[model samples]
Target: MDLGLKGKNAIVTGATRGIGRAIADLLADEGVNVSVCARKADEVAATVSALEAKGVKAFGQVVDIADAAALQGFVRASAEALGGLDILVSNASALVQGARPEDWKAMFEIDILGAVNALDAARPHLEAAAGKTGDAAVVLISSISAAEAAAPSAYGAMKAAQIHFAKGVAREGAPKGLRCNVVSPGTVFFEGGVWGNVKAAMPAFFEQMLKRNPTGRMATPEEIAAATVFLCSPRSAFTTGINMVVDGGISQRANF
Candidate 1:
């Protein structure tokens, strides 16, 4: 299970909690230097400290993903601090599952454009690292909602856009030895996450969703992270331009 991740460096956005945090933690566990960002300053500091405790170089910044300047700044600073970037995980989401204009705007700015800006900033560093290692990856955290049509929401549209965008990035970056892929997780559950709040406020609905999964439960953040970090590893060097669904079979669509 050696992933060839030791000594590599990565940036994971919205990494102070939940799936993003899990991805950063797992990467650090595999000896990858990690730079992470979230909006809260104290949480960022604590996460950075926790990751550093795992014996990998770790950096954190308080960043509002909706702000392109701040998002790009973090990416550039992370690349400088980490010496280079081999992996970039666009894990932030606005979580706006509504049809309003404001909802669409937020999703576009934070979820879609946030990733766009980060990739732009990291492109040079990723290209350089790819030249040396022949393995650089970008894993976008999408959702199964991207393919499923439970309702018309800006969230699903933006998530679908991310998958499409990653496909293009994969094709264009391949010549430079960079791989881009999407990890579409379905109903991942964690404390203070979407499902956790649903369980508290709308028990019946939450139970319905829980029952919908043949596994009798939703995915854990760690499960999604494991898939994501693996795709970002040299172990999956040939994996690109693909949407790897990690939903415990909750998603019925055959990947092929």
Candidate 2:
């Protein structure tokens, strides 16, 4: 299916690895010029090189998403570098699950403010793109934990906050042909990721978690990316203010 993404430009945060990298790769595959940012300079460079090899214009910068000024600067630079921005994917997170004060602070700074800052920086560019093409999109990479609470978790609370933010953005941007949505993944597994670490250090607990999924496995980064990139595409022009869960049936909550 043609995603209608060719010639568009996008910026993705935390694009060096995991789901962020997967989203960037898929956007590039669909002929979108992409600008990516991550904390590691080497990873950012390598990711840019890889994206360029796909025959699309690609740019990357080392950025700390927790720094609002730096992140907003990167977004503006990306729009200028790529000529305009039609898509924005906020995929960076602190991934802090503890109930400590420091953990909450980190999650709020990176997970919540990160998405807010990116959108604030990209709003004008996105609105302009929508004016020309009749569509522009923002996809926030949240988690199914947003709706599930087995304990007090800053991670889950911040994730839930992201959903609320997306909905508001969608409503506000609707008149301008700009859409915002959230992609909430359940237990996504990739090398060096949370689940991967668990699998290596706590095999029994990892196995227990794995068995909870009806699919008998956790989702791959690519799986989550597919859903994300699609939502960012013009193909899903009408899909906005919605949380699309891609959890491989591990999340029991009904989306409706």
Candidate 3:
């Protein structure tokens, strides 16, 4: 299946490890020029080298997603480096699960505002790309926690807010051929990731989470990345304003 993504330019936030890294790699594999940003200079450099090794133009920079100016700057720089931006994926998060006020603030700053800032910075480039290619996309990485509620969680609340934001972008950008969508992953596991740390530190809780998935396990970062990249592809030109859940049946709610 040719994704018709070769030569397209993309920017992915937090594209150094886990799902973000997987998405960046997959995009490179599809022959898309990629620009990535993360806080760690070493990881960002390594990721760029790895992507360039795949024979695609790649750029990276150290960026703090919580800082609006820094994040917007990265996006603009990336668009300039990559020639233009056809896809934008906001994958950075604060990963704050606590109920404290500070935790909520962190999530709002990094997750909510980060997505907003990235879209604002990339909108012009994306719209210009749409003028040339007839399609442009923005994929927001969200989570199944947005639809589920067990306790007070800033993470879930902010994720839900992202979904709402994406919907509005989708509607507003539809006429401009700028698509916006959300990909909600559930219990993604990778080495040194949240689930991996949970499995090592709290085996019982990890096992409980595993059993909750009908697949009898969790999703891999690659699995989530596949869904994300596909949504950004020209083949999915009409797939906008939709929250695609790649949760391995862990989420029970049916999409209407």
Candidate 4:
């Protein structure tokens, strides 16, 4: 029941809303000292306040992960604020648009480059924690799109690259007591946003999405967050360099 998370410090990127926010709240609830970040200063402060209400130490920063230097500064600040870092959840970026040549830049910048920035900056702190308890872990928030073609172009390709890079990081960092793994969520519904955007921008595509999934439903952010926390916990001590997919059987059916 303890989850052994009390006093453990964590950094959750993109923590102002949606899945990142949910993950931050859950970690704080379990007694983890958490530092959350977003590009907006007000949103970061507000999110930290919300987490503080849960009675755990929390910090927030305005970090544009697309900028490596800024993200490094944010990580260092988070470590300084929390006294140390034991867990890192790299949950940054908007799910990029598909592989039109124009979408390439933004997709790679956020999805690929941003991940490199966070993981690199947090390695030292995470390594120190691993040295202390042999349990420090980095959880890369990927998507089920990595395994399927549903998400299309830039998003899907970059995600697949994330998985490969995560594995390489796991192998390199494992010797230093660091662990890295990827968590992929399928069709996560982020209410009042994408679903609605899809309805207005492209209705037929949305309908096809609903029909492709065997469960006739999309996953909630909380459901994905639970799996994410498990990966970060001692519960998954031996799990690394893997992609744990959470899709309502969406990726399994080849012929829908």
Best by lDDT: 3
Every model's TM-score: 0.98, 0.99, 0.99, 0.92
Model 4 C-alpha lDDT per residue in residues 1-256, reported as the tens digit of each score? 6577788999999888888988998899888999998988999999999989999889988887888899899899999999999999988865776688767777788878888888788888998998998889898888877867854578888888889989998888877778889888888777655665776788898888888889887777889888888888876788888888888788874522
lDDT of 3 by residue, 16-115 (tens): 9999999999999999999999999999999999999999999999998998999999999999999999999999999999889999999999999999
Candidates ranked, most accurate by lDDT first: 3, 2, 1, 4
Considering lDDT, which of the candidate structures 3 and 4 is the better prediction for this target?
3
Considering summed lDDT, which 10 consecutive residues are worst modelled in model 3?
A: 247-256
lDDT of 1 by residue, 124-154 (tens): 9999999998989999999999999878899
* Candidate 2 whole-model C-alpha lDDT, 0 to 1: 0.96
Model 1 lDDT on a 0 to 1 scale:
0.94
| CA lDDT for candidate 3 | 0.96
Candidate 3: residue 132 Cα off by (Å)? 0.6
Give the alpha-carbon lDDT of every model.
0.94, 0.96, 0.96, 0.85
